[model samples]
Target: MKLDIIDLNLSYGSTKVLNGLNMQAKPEITALIGPNATGKSTLLKCVAGILKPTGHILLDGEEILDKRNKELREMISYLPQEIPDLTTLTVMEVVLLGRVNSLSWKVSEEEIDQAYGVLEDLGLDDLAPRPMTELSGGQQQMIYVAQSLVRNPSLLLMDEPTNNLDMQKQLEMFELIKGVTAEKEITTLMVLHDINLASRYADQIVVLRDGKVFCSGPAEEVINEDIIQEVYGVKSTVHFHQDGFPQIVPLCSVRCLPWQKRKDQGLAHQGSVDFGQQN
Candidate 1:
């Protein structure tokens, strides 16, 4: 499947969030990375139909905005940044909720099996009978991820999916997501803050700046010292491992150029300072 976002625009009352943003992704994992307030989450929301935008969102060359609610739900699954704490439910019950649309008067055996199957795949089967309140935050996040997967969505939208996890859990979650999404050929768009993690795992990377795509391509093509400085305003070194993935070692934030500081003070300079060598 291919996702094509064309001339997309969104706003919050008067303040614009996304402005004529265009992007394309194939059936693979694509990581959206940018500084704060760049509308990464808003873009995902528009695609998931949680928030409406003013342009065409096409999946496999067909427009999806006009589709019915059921069709839209089948096509996409979204996990927001903050998942509400519903400790009263069991893990099995929570995951079964993903199939609420397909359920009738009684929950079927096949649905229960499907929910268990997904939890097992994520190594959370042991927690199925446990109350959600008894598990750690990372464990609950995994349960929610399994719930999203049980919907069998063609496209998955995750905003900051690794919010509360420690380093080990984050790695485990990414490995699971990569394996499952690739095996099922699902198109996933995720907003992530860790540049190194994105470089290591993402099949494609989209860099957002000022609510626009500053750069986007394969990881090696888009992630470099120059782009990092330009888009993230950070100095960094990028190196490739033997596995052929880029690894980023961030140095420090880019210091303000002399000309910019002078300009801020309402003064003009005869010669401009070279930001390239400023750091």
Candidate 2:
């Protein structure tokens, strides 16, 4: 499943969010990383067909921009950044809803089993009967992931799928995502804020800046200190793991030194004024 973006342009009212964006997503996990308002989320939304773009989005060389909603739903699964509160449904029921697009009128026993299998695979079997409203944010995140997987989509786009989880839960989420993606060979693209997490899990990384791609390639090629500072405006040291994955340790904001210089000059000016007054 090859996903290709060609001269993609998207706008919200008058402001352009994605400007001539181009990418070819591999069959493995690809991480979309950038600072705020750089179109990370917007790019996912455009590809998922939630927000229409003026350019082309192709799946396996077929144009997907003109596909019907049902057809698009069958090929792709998109999880938004904010998980809505499901007050009326249990965890199992919420996951079963993923099968709705493929189902006819009545739900089948095989579909029920499939949903249960997904929940159990993600270790959410214990919470199956529990109401979604009763679960923690991390627990709900797991359930939403289960819902996304139940559809068995060829393309999975997740927007910050691990927003509020603790460190351990975040690791678990990434492991589960990577496991399923590799096992199913799903073409997965996710918006991630943490550069280290993206480098660890992504087969390729795309960095966006000011509604355009700054640089994109394998983690080692794109996650250098210079690119990090250029894209994110932060001074970072990138180290490679023994397995050859990149890790980013942010030192400070690049603007921090300039701000400190201005502060010192202000103090010096005040001292000169005080000395003149004393004289």
Candidate 3:
């Protein structure tokens, strides 16, 4: 499936969130990375049809502005940054909510099977009977991701999906998301905070700044240190792995030259003193 954003403009009350934004998303994971308040979430919300934009979005070449709520919801699934507060439902019950948009009155047997499948795929099958409020933060995140995927959408938009996940679970989540998106042939766009993971997993990366796109292209072209510093205002050293994927090492504040500050004081900074060298 293909999703197209055409000069999308969105405003809340008076402030514009997306200013003439444009993008084309396909059946691959696209990472939207930027600093805070840059409207990454706003762009995703607009594309998902949660918020009506001033311009148009095309789903499979059809204008989304003309589509109704159920029609648009069927085509796209959106996972918000914060988990929903549903205390009355079990984990599986909450996941089954993914199908509620299609239900006329009652949930179907097929929907039950689909929800269970999503839970198992997300490693949340064991938590099926637990209350929504009883799960850990990472567990809740996984369940929410499962809830979004249970719909088998044409496009999935995740807003900061790995907010509280540990390092191990984070890797697992990315692997699972990649597998699902590939197997299901669903286009995935997510607001990712981890640049390294985005570089490794996403086929496309879009950088945003001040409600506008700073730069966007393949992850290879957009993951350099220059773009990082330019978009994030922090000095970082970027290194490429053998596979040519980029990894970023954020340095100290951009204000001072630490080496120069040390040298100016004549503190006997010896020649190439490698700390804790075995030799």
How good is model 2 by TM-score?
A: 0.90
Model 1 quality (TM-score): 0.88
**What ranking of all candidate models by TM-score puts the best one first?**
2, 1, 3
C-alpha TM-scores of all predictions:
0.88, 0.90, 0.87
For residues 1-279, write the lDDT of model 1, one tens digit per residue.
799999999989898899889999888999999999999999988888878889999999999888877888878998888887678999998898888853344788998999999998878899999999999988998888888889888999889888888898789889988987899999989999998889888999999988889899889999889999988888999999898888889999888888789989998686758567554
Give candidate 2's whole-model lDDT: 0.88
Predicted structure with the largest TM-score when compared to the true one: 2
* Candidate 1 wrongly placed segments (more than 4 Å): 101-105, 255-279
Write candidate 3's Cα lDDT for 90-199 as tens digits.
88788888888523559989988999988887777989999978888888888888889988898899999998899988999899889999998999999988888999
Better of 1 and 3 by lDDT: 1
Ranking by lDDT: 1, 2, 3
Q: State each model's CA lDDT, in order.
A: 0.89, 0.88, 0.86
lDDT for each residue of candidate 2 in 1-279, tens digit (9 for 90 to 100): 899999999888899899999998968999999999999999998888888888899999999999988999989999999766675788988888788943345888998899999988877898989998898878888889889998898999999988877898788888988998999999999999998999999999999988888889989999999998888888988889998998989999967575588787774433344435553
Clash count per candidate? 0, 0, 0
| Model 3 stretches astray by more than 4 angstroms | 102-104, 255-279
Poorest stretch of ten by lDDT in candidate 2: 267-276
